[model samples]
Every structure is written in structure tokens, then in C-alpha cells.
Target: MNSLRKEPLGGGSSEPLPVAIIGNGPSGICLSYLLSGNTPYVKSHAVHPHPLLQRKLMETPGVSIMDQDLDYLSEGLEGRCESPVALLFDALLRPDTDFGGDMESVLTWKHEKERTVPHVVLGRNLPGGAWHSIDGSMVTLSQGQWMGLPDLQVKDWMRKKRRGLRNSRATAGDIAHYYRDYVTKKGLEHNFVSGAVVTAVKWEGLEPQDSGAQDSRPLFQVSGFLQNAQDPSPQPFILRARNLVLATGTYDSPARLGVPGESLPFVHHELAALEAAMRAGTVTPASEPVLIVGAGLSAADAVLYARHCNVPVIHAFRRSVDDPGLVFNQLPKMLYPEYHKVHQMMRDQSFLSPGPYEGYLSLPQHQLLLLKEDCQAVFRDPRGGQKAFGVSLVLVLIGSYPDLSFLPGGGALLTMDPSQPLSAKRNPIHVDPFTYQSTHQEGLYALGPLAGDNFVRFVQGGALAAASSLLRKETRKPP
Candidate 1:
């Protein structure tokens, strides 16, 4: 119920912003779209598998779906998705086709510019965030249609460019391009502050009693610098807002092994560097087998790519092939045959001798102990004996964490402990599922992967939740 100050940070405008979104990923783009008053409406005669939900939506024809009784609407809907409301949105969009079937949309969007909220989206990269930095040729786990933003389908965009999908699969480069173009295509370009790094964000003092309610929210000061073509140097800037949204997805910070020689030049964390090395012929089949660590999809991708180049691969992982909790095991085999193939190799190689996989080898239940400067990897075998293997390069794909170092408490604020990284699989931020708001931080919201909505399709629902909460607060008159 706090009435914010109209004072400028330095020589800027006096009016304070209603919202300031962090990260220009899909979540940020979708939130910006909503804040711009590009409202979504349920089409009349919108056919859904859930007749009761459809009936309720049709009754309020003029209301935006974002403003509907989301929790009630989300009930009784089951999907292979995280957010139920997001599943509801998918149901509305695709109607009866809940599981990967192609169909027409049942929702419509209209620009109601008058309802727009004043906000800014400060992002480190362009629009796609982590997608921008992924290997160009690598295929995405999700289908092409699933990667698109709400309005413009990625397949539709590809048609414009005279491109077609191969078995509905989209490459990482295509997805990155689609998200970058979505911001401008949807007219949300003006709201994004691309190529800016947030240095620090701190909760400042609350306004006096004259500001409105006794429990007025603390003012948030965001300090950052812009990096762009105009000036390569850092241009310092400051911004303040009443509502803060953290849409920063987990990708910037790569999780480390903490072993000696892990930081060596030949050792790579992200896939981009390894891809670059492979493409440049720096890593060849004649070289010692490339050592890959981790059992995630990224690790699988590393093995696949290495083998494709005729390079022998020696994959190391802590988990066994039959571990159901592994990321590769969760993917649908038909859609992700490449990943499953790598998993199959792990399974096949487990019982056989080392040379059974042709150019690939799996070290199941192997624990890496040390790495020498000469590219010799020391690992503890399943038998508890330490052994060494020479390798051309070491690729660590153990997954990544979000860079929340900008916060005054650093990443420890979000993860509770930096030594133990925040993981979407294990330690996602506990938020109000309906509003995506942080339970401990008033006026603060989380979107996208930070709030556990990892998929591109689910991210919009998180955005919608935040926008709905924001609009509700905006409409309430000061006490």
C-alpha cells in the first residue's frame, strides 16, 4: 500500500517506475509484453478438453485470461509440465492437443495500450539470454513450436525466412534468433535495456508515513552499467522501482568441480568453447579420447558431438546408466533419439569391455578425483581404486546456476549458500505459485527458471502471474 516517491535518482525523471524486470530472456519479454497492455483473451467457442474450465472462461468473454481465477482454472488439468496454470494456457492455446500434437490456437491477443504499466527490462544479453550463447548447430530438446513466444510461432517465422523444420526439431541458433526477433516483432523492444550488467541491487529505506500505509515496501536501488557498440567502456546508470522482478534464468554461472587443474585452458565448462574447438579441428580423432564429465543432457551432447567428429570419447559420470533420475532418461526417446542414443551407449558399454562402443566409452559410477596439467585425469573407479587416463580436452557439463551476485547478499541470498548452488531440479526458489512472488521478499517476484518454470512454454504463465499480481496492486487506491 506504499505510495512511491516521484524523486529522480540523479538528473532523471521524477516519476518512479511501477516495475523493473531483470533479464531479457523469454520471461522478461513475456512480462514486458503484458505490461505493455498486449492483453490475451480467450476466443469464444474455444474448445478445450476440460469442458468445465472452458465453460468458466467463456462466461467472462471480455476479461483477459491473465485476470481469471487462475487457481480454479488450473484444477483437474494434468500435463507433463511444471506450472498447472501454464498447462492451462497450453490447453487454451492448443485445445485438445495437450501432448505435442500440432493444432491451431484458441486464444487471441489485442493491444490495449491504455492499460500499459511503466516498466523497464534490464538484460545482460539481447532477448534470448542463455539461448544466445548456446552452440548454433545443437538441436533443442523441445520441439520447434514449443520454443516460440506466445503470438508468433517459430515455424511461422521460419516460413517467412523460407526455412523448414526437420521433424519439428529446432536448432539452438534458430531458437536464439527467434527470441531476439520476438522482442522487436511484438513491439517490446523499447522496454529492454540489452547488454547491461547489473552490478548491485539493494533494498533501501522506506518512505515516511506520508507515503501511505505503515508497512510501506522498501525502495529498491538498482545500479548497473551498459555495454554496447556506441561505447565499449562501461556507462554507469541507476534505476529505482516499486516492484522488482527476477527473470534471470540459470546459465551465466557454470557449476564447477572444484578439483585441481579444473581451470586449465584445455578444460571447458560451457558447450560453446568445446563446439568451437571441434569445428576448428583443434580436437581430432587422432588426439587422446576427449573426457566428458556429468550425466546431464549437456554432458550427453558433449559425447555425441565428440563422437560425430570421429574423436574417441571417454565419458565420466557419477551416476549409473540405469539411474532413472538422470536427465537423459527423462526425455522421450522418439523426440530425443540423439540423447537416448548416448544413453544407450552408456548402457551398452557398462557390461562390455572398453573398446565395445567403437569411438565411445562410458565410465559409469566413476568419480573424478584430480586433473593434471598434462591432461591426465585421475578418477576413482567403482572398485575404489584410483586410476589415470590421458585425454585431449576435458568438458564439464554438470549444469549451471544463475548469476545473482548483483544482490547485496550475492547468490547466497537466493541459494541460502553459494557453496551449494541453486538448482531447478533440487533447490528452486520457493515462490507463490500463483503470483511468482518471493515468499520472504515483499514486492519481489521471480519468473522463468528461477521460479521453476523451466520450459519456454511455461515461462509465459509465470509472466502472466506476475503481471496479474502487479495489475491488482496497481488498481488498488492508496490507503
Candidate 2:
């Protein structure tokens, strides 16, 4: 498993190098696995193995995983793990189990490819990416089957661990463990370099042309700091690649509610404290109501966690109460009674009348004006009233956007569709849906949630699309 070596970064090489994969999350891991032409890990019950995809990947090589934190790769294995879907077991195996089943298959696949292109992974910890920071016990929004990467089946992993598979959803811990196992079982760990952070990605203009014509082929300069040394200071280095992949998903930058008092100690952007309370079974009712801002899954989780602790909830959102486009509508009410109940209670609230629920209050189309130190929230109420509500804690979960600040030129090198509405323009990095390559830049690419495929199940498509494009480019390169 430790066969893959981390090569030192040096210049002056004329050989084609591996594609630099930034952010070793599921998207990056899957891309690397596919690009390596390793056999997909299929379980015993896997049906309709993806022979087509296997054939596709077998032709491509030279891919690597890069990340700032590598510890995330194995974080899930350390705790109670779950996935939104049976990602590892069902989804990945359903369409193509043969491509990604076991070590023997992977070895055989490699031998068949003949010329194995060496790939290197750079990171500070494991390649779990954002999953490492997730709460181990937190259940995913989707079922377990939908959470698998392209090769590993989460359901199979759970089965091997002797964990119950009856539950539709898997925990965050389950996903982390699956990633770590995938890297080890697939023999990808050797290629991984711990303690590396990609700081800048610069697309150097084409080499000076003797013919006085602009060269279409661009050389990319990827600069980073490697912290593998015992010393605290990071060692700065750079690598040159033909292409660059940005798999750093949106979770890195959380959307903020830019109101006054948001910096206060009582305000929390995440539910770590609430999750801890639920795990401890500390249901002691709070004296003050907990304020939850936003309408997404995180806000809903906060409401549920607060209610589980018998703490009063004051849910606030900008969406109208009657908005059918809410995320809750996507869930099956029969299976998720709490979400259904909460939605119903919120819907019962009226502008003219009080809500039926005594302890829970839902405020729609209201903006948080300020969060006072004494657990007080000033709101620009939807009913044209400036109201102040008492609160012990504030959970703000409006949503998250991608942070491409690390990109050179502050995102101007990227492009957005001018035809897109003003609101959509806020997300500036537009890419070809089929290729995942930036519409503006030639060699730059984006994948995962950053590319707009928010769900885990669909993330594989982005990776596949990007890999396909890069492989095509590789084939086109002159010998």
C-alpha cells in the first residue's frame, strides 16, 4: 500500500507530468482513481458493473490528489459514521461494480494497462477534505446508497464493520471511513503526500514562439507550501502541469449573514455545540429560545437538535411560508416526521394571527438586523414591524458559496455567462457541463459542488467529465 512515493518538486523536466488535483475530497479521489486506471472496487451484490466506465478509465492515467489537510481521509473511521445515502454499497456498485471491487481486480486492471503512469498526491493529512470536519454522528440528508464514490460502496463497508444497514441514511463518519479505506484498499495511499497546501495556480502564457504565433498549449505553474518537515515552517515549492483541476468544494467558505453583533461569542455558524448536546442526551430545557436563521438542511438540523433538547426554537428565513420550493418538500414526510412536523408548524403561522405552536415560532421573509449580547435578536419583520426577540444562541446557516480567492487575479481570469441573471452571476466560475473545464480558461477546470453538482451521487459525473477532457488533451499532445 505504501508503494506510491512522493517525489520532490523540481523544474526543467520535459516529460508530461500528472494533472494536479486540488482538494482530495470524494471528487478529487474519484478523479485520481479513474485517471490511474485502477479497477473499480465492486462488492459481492454489485449488479451491472460499469464496464464502459472501466474501459474509459483504463485509457487514461497521470492523476494526483492534493489537499491542505489529509487527516480527513480517515476521520470517519474513528467515530460513528453515516452517509446521506448508502453511497459505498449501493450507488457506486449499481451501474458498474466490476470496475472498482477489490485489490486483485485493481492489480489486474493495472497490468492490463501495461504502462502505469505514476501519480502523486500532496496533502497535510488524509484526503477526506471537508468530510474530516463534519460531525461523525450527523446523518446525511440523502440515503446511504447515494453517498458512495465512483468505486467504493458505503453499504458494503458498513456490512463489513457489522453495522446495521436498515437505516436509509449514513452518518458523516461512515463517509470518512469509506474514503480512508478506499485509498488504502485501492493502493492510493503511497501516492499521497501529507502536509502540502496548494497556495497559487498560475497559468503561464504559452512558451515564447519562434514563429511569432501564440501557442495554444499553456503551461500551468502550481505553487504550494509543503509542511512535511519536523520544523513548524512550511517549505515552499512549485510544480508544473499541463492541466489543473479545482476540486475544492464550496464548504470551505460559509455564507454569512452580514448583520451587526454577528461576531459575538454566542453566535454560531455551525451546530457543533448543539450536536454535542444531543450526543450527551443533555435535554435540560434552556431558559431562552434558540434562534435558527436560514431554511436549508443545516438550519433544519439546528431546529431538530434544539427541539430534541427541549429548547425553544425561533426559526427565521427569507423564503415565504407558502413557498413550495423549499428543500423540505423534497423529503418523504412519512420517513422524516420531524422535518414534516416542523414544516407544517411553520406553515401554520400567519401574518395576522399567532402560530399554533406555543414554543416554536417561524418568521418568514424577515431579516436579522442585529444580535445583542443579552441573547436578543432585532429583526426587520416581514409584517413591516421592527421586532426584537429574546434568544440564548444563534445558528446561522443561510448557505455556502465557493471560495476561489486563492486563484490568481481574484477570479477575473474566470468567466460567467453574461446571459445569466444578476443573482446567478454571484457564482462566477462557469464551466462546460460536459467537460467541467472552465468556459473562460482553457486548462483550468472545476468539479463537485463548486461546479454546481451539489449532491454526492452526481459528483462522480463531474470527475468523469473532467478526466475525459484531460485524457483527450493528453492524447492530443505531440510525442
Candidate 3:
């Protein structure tokens, strides 16, 4: 769909202008879609980290990421924790090719030295998936899953038969393509600014830096670096907007598992030299007992990957899956906007699992830890005489937190709520409950996971919806 010049609002003038959307995840893309055709009074600009991906989006036809395989590859790459080693390994290992007849046994030997913990892998849904486009942007899709659970019911109902499921992977660029098509079709492509990273947001009407010179002028500075350009030094830019939305998603950095031997070169984060290790036949089950920390989606993915590779796997977490995290609200509330804004805001939230939780071929969190404790439990091939490989790699898939060092004037602009102790380290941005505006400063908004603390518990859909709703409100003209 193309953007059309429409009759001006109130039959006087054209729509004033569109608002700017400063992030390119699902939330941001979805936000752009919802705002299109809203009286043409406001438009949106989606600021994407990768611009070339957005450019390539313009060539495709109607919005559809139909190729499932490409979708998996994209997810594998983008979702890789620190690097693409795991994906590299998958690429190199051809199907039906044996690392060794005793490949499972070999993997056991490696686990004792380290632990391969459970982690989540996201992928796209099957054929004819919805396409995201904005303006001239369009994208193509291939077969694969994109960091979400495969929907068996949907497939079964449509095809009336189930096919053997293959592995899925993707990269940041790949997903960006899917979104490009999604937003473009919705005629919201102009709402994005690609290749830009928002650095800091200066609040208007805030106190002066020195306080010695007092002048009440509302101004804020935004610093960011440009991509795909020849500038050697970190190029800086600034912005002056009445409102700023921070949609930078979670996983600002890999959460390190603080334990003995964690700092050793042999140990690595989720994105460590996965390809090299796999190619060398080094990534495998433990010869000693393997211990996995954290029992969330990431841990689940790690276990599944290891299982697919024929390696014996173990899973662990401080809490059970049924009680994954603290539940924000069990049901919708009768009264809205009552009591503390944060508390009331959470009443309508719900939790949805993205992958297989517990079932055949999938061991429970407690079972995995028991194997670690007893040292005799073997995860794969129960009937075989193979011994348990001692633990080697300990993959900690428990959880992640944000590191706010990137923001300029850090502590002065945002700080942790003293009332919440568990989330103190996270230091989530405290935004105005009603408008999603930062409480400490004006013209600054916090959306998505960064703003979901205490109330929302970090879900993707709600964060994006809230941001879009608030932005529309800010730009909407009165009747």
C-alpha cells in the first residue's frame, strides 16, 4: 500500500505531521501499523538499528515471509547470545552426518568440564505469515521459527497432518526484513529512521547542571552514532522533541552466572565460540554431571538444541516452570487507575509461554538438577551402557537485566525506585503510569521491557501497545 495525500483535518489543512517511532522490534513495528490512517493527523518514523535491511525491504511484492527455512536462519543469527558459533555449527553439520557413532557419548565427556544450560530459541511461524512493511519497505521470508514456540494446533487444523519439525534459527537482519514488509504494507514506512541509536534524553524544565546559573528554559539533548557511514570516530547527533520514547528491548547485555570457574577462558556466555567448538566435535554432553542454572525460555532452548544434536541434556532453575516468575495480576481488575498507578496498571496482564515446557523427550527442571547431584543420571539413551559425562559447560539461562551506562547524564536522569529491592539492580525507568512518561523527567517515555518492571513483568505485546497508544494520544488533534 502507498501513502496517499488525503483531505486535511477539519477540511482546513493536511495532517500536521507524523510522530517518530525510535526502535524497530516487533513492538515498534506493530506500533507503526496501528497509527497508520488515524485521521492522517499523525505519522510515524521507525528508527531501525540496521538500515540496509530496511532498504532491501522495498523490492518485495505483497507482504509475506513465506520461506520458512530463511526465517529459521534469520532467527538463529539474531538470537545468538554473544556470537554465531552455535549457528555456525548447525550450518556445518549436515543432517544424518554423525559426529561419531558414539557422538552422544563424546558429548557426555565434554559436559563435566562445563555445563550447557537451557535457553530459549525464537523462530517464525509457518507458510504465508503476515508481512510487516512501512512506506517503500518490504521483506521476504523463508521457512523457520523466530524466537517463538511452534504452533502445532494451527498447523494440524489447517493441513490435517503433522510433519516432522526441523530446527529453527534467525538473525537480527532477517527479522528486520519481516518487519519491513509488515510496516510498509500498513503504509507506515515513513515512521522510521534507520541506522540510528538514541543515546540520551534530556528533560525540559529540569534543574541546571551547575545551578549557579538559573534560567528556566526547557531543552534536552539526544546523542547517537550513525551506521554504514565512513565516520571513524563515534559520530554524535542530537534531537529536541517534546516527547521521547525508549523502546530499546531487554538483554542490554548478557547476564553472567556468578559462580566458581565462571571467569575461566573455557567458560563463555550463550554466544561463545559455538561454531568452533561444534565443528571440532567439542560441544557435547557432560562426562561428569552437568548443571544448568536458570529455568526460563533460554534454558529450554539450550536443552532442545543439545537434544537435537543428540547430546544428553540437563535443565535447572531456582523456581518451577508453573510458577515461572512473580505473576503480576491473575485477572482483570474491576476498577482501573485506582491505588498506585503501577499496581493498577498490571491488573490486565497475562503470561504466555513461547515454547514446549514439559513433555516426553523433555526432562523437568528438578530431574536435570538431580542428575547433577547424583552424578549417574544420563539424559539420552537410557537403555545404553554409556556412563554420565562429567559436567564441563554450565549454560546459565536464568534471566537478564539492563545496563543503563549507555545513557548520558545517567543517574541524574533516571534512578531505581528505592521501594523495590529485588529490581534495584535493574533500575527500571520509572515512567508516569498514565502516559508512559518518565516520572523523573518530562518529554521522555519508557516503553517495552525496560518499563515493564513490577507491573507488566516483561511481555512484548503490552509494552508495544502501550507505547503506540500513548504516542497517538500525544499527536491526536481534538475534534
Using TM-score as the measure, the top candidate is 1
Question: lDDT values of the candidates?
Answer: 0.79, 0.64, 0.36
Which structure is stronger by lDDT: 2 or 3? 2
Q: Model 2, range 1-479, lDDT digits (tens) per residue?
A: 21212343544465535577777778878777767755333233323334543433333333211111112211222211122112222223343332333322221122224223345555545777778778777677766766776544677788998765435777788877778788878767755655667778777767432367566567678777767546677767677776778877777566788998999987878887666644665423755778889987788877777776678888899888667788788777855776777788777853445777677888888889988888799998876789898877778987776666668755545646445421211554678765678888787887776665666676775675666566556644221
Worst 10 residues of 1 by lDDT: 1-10
lDDT of 2: 0.64
In candidate 2, stretches whose alpha carbon ends up further than 4 angstroms from where it belongs are: 1-16, 39-117, 121-125, 205-216, 226-232, 273-284, 348-359, 418-428, 475-479
Off by over 4 Å in 3: 1-22, 33-177, 204-217, 229-234, 271-276, 284-291, 320-390, 408-416, 419-428, 453-476
Worst 10 residues of 2 by lDDT: 65-74
TM-score of each: 0.92, 0.76, 0.47
Off by over 4 Å in 1: 1-11, 208-213, 279-281, 350-352, 411-421, 477-479
Tens digit of lDDT per residue, candidate 1, span 1-479? 01112223231864557788888888888888888988788776667557888777777777888777788778888886778777777777666665546767878999887668878888777788888888778888877888877889888899997877766789888888988888878887767777778898888777442456566776678887777766677767787778889989989788899998899989989777767877888887788988899999898888887777788888889987889898877887887888888888888875245546787888899989999998899999998998799998899989888878888665455542345656765677667878888776878888888878888877888888888888777655221
Sort every candidate by TM-score, greatest first: 1, 2, 3
Give model 3's clash tally: 91
Residue 182's lDDT within candidate 2 is: 84
> Which digits, one per residue and each the tens of the lDDT, describe model 3 over residues 1-479?
11111211111332222233355555454434433422111002322222433333233423221111222322333321211222222222211112211111000001111111111101111111122221111111112232221111112222333322222223333344434444454445555544554555445444332358664334444445434344445434444433455555555456765554455544545623432455576665433223444444345445444544455434443333345252213312332111112222122211122234221122222222223432333333223223343454556565665544545554335544634421223666675543455677655555555665321112223333343344344543221
Ranking by lDDT: 1, 2, 3
What is candidate 2's TM-score against the reference?
0.76
